[model samples]
Target: MPKMIFVNLPVRDLAASTTLYLALGGTLNPQFSGEQSSSIMFSDAIGVMLLTHAHYGVFTKRPIGDARRDSQVLLALSVDSRDAVDATLARAVAAGGRADPNPAQDHGFMFSRSVEDPDGYVWEIMWMDPAAIAGTPETA
Candidate 1:
């Protein structure tokens, strides 16, 4: 199998963050999850490690930046269709997350929406037309 990707994010509350991820359609991988952290499986190749601030501090010397005040990273995930993108955002809002302050994006062949999880991490949910991507002119 190819290598998988794991996004480690620090959160204030592990249980609340875990609930938000579960509502986003992610499965909890108990093997790597515990009271201080949660391993959320978005797919076979993608996983998110939600760690409590204290637990997360063990891995870094710098202070944990407050995502609500500043942005460190924007985690984006590609979905199957425009409807799926909308559905995911809707689910996010219903699960105690907030919608993006920016307006919805519609770029002809692509559609996107953003949401902030309970911990203020931004997640970009997007869908793009395969044909449109394939038809793009190549540059040297």
Candidate 2:
């Protein structure tokens, strides 16, 4: 079986966070979700577990850091094309996220933009030329 990744995030408002994820093209997984938490599946192998701050504390005794002011981690998502990256950012903004929290990156081979969710968690949406990843040049 292939390994899957489920990133756990602490959210201040579960409903709002779930809505933002849905707007960003995630599907809700009811089986793994509840009043205190939500499972948003981005792909078969990628998922985000949005946990209420109280519920999140159950897993760790450390206090939750304010994502808006302090940076602990920057989550990144790879999309198929540059347009997809822009679309994802747009959706995030429409759902109450702040766009371009970080400077946008635009190397010839890769492009990226960032969005900060209502709770201040940052997600970088990016795209890269497959040829560049494969260490090959594009052909005419």
What value does the lDDT take at residue 64 in candidate 2? Answer: 91
Assess every candidate by TM-score.
0.91, 0.94
Report the alpha-carbon TM-score of model 2 versus the true structure: 0.94
Residue pairs clashing in model 1 are none
- Alpha-carbon deviation at 2 in model 2, angstroms: 1.2
- Per-residue lDDT tens digits for candidate 2, residues 1-140, read 88999999999999999999898889999999999999999999999999999999999999999988999897998889999999999998898888998999999899999999988889999999998888755543
Candidate 2 lDDT: 0.93
lDDT of 1 by residue, 1-140 (tens): 88999999999988888888887779999999998899999999999999988999999989999998898887888888999998988888888889875567899899998989887888888999987867756621
- What's the C-alpha lDDT at position 132 in model 2? 84
Query: Each model's number of backbone clashes?
Result: 0, 0
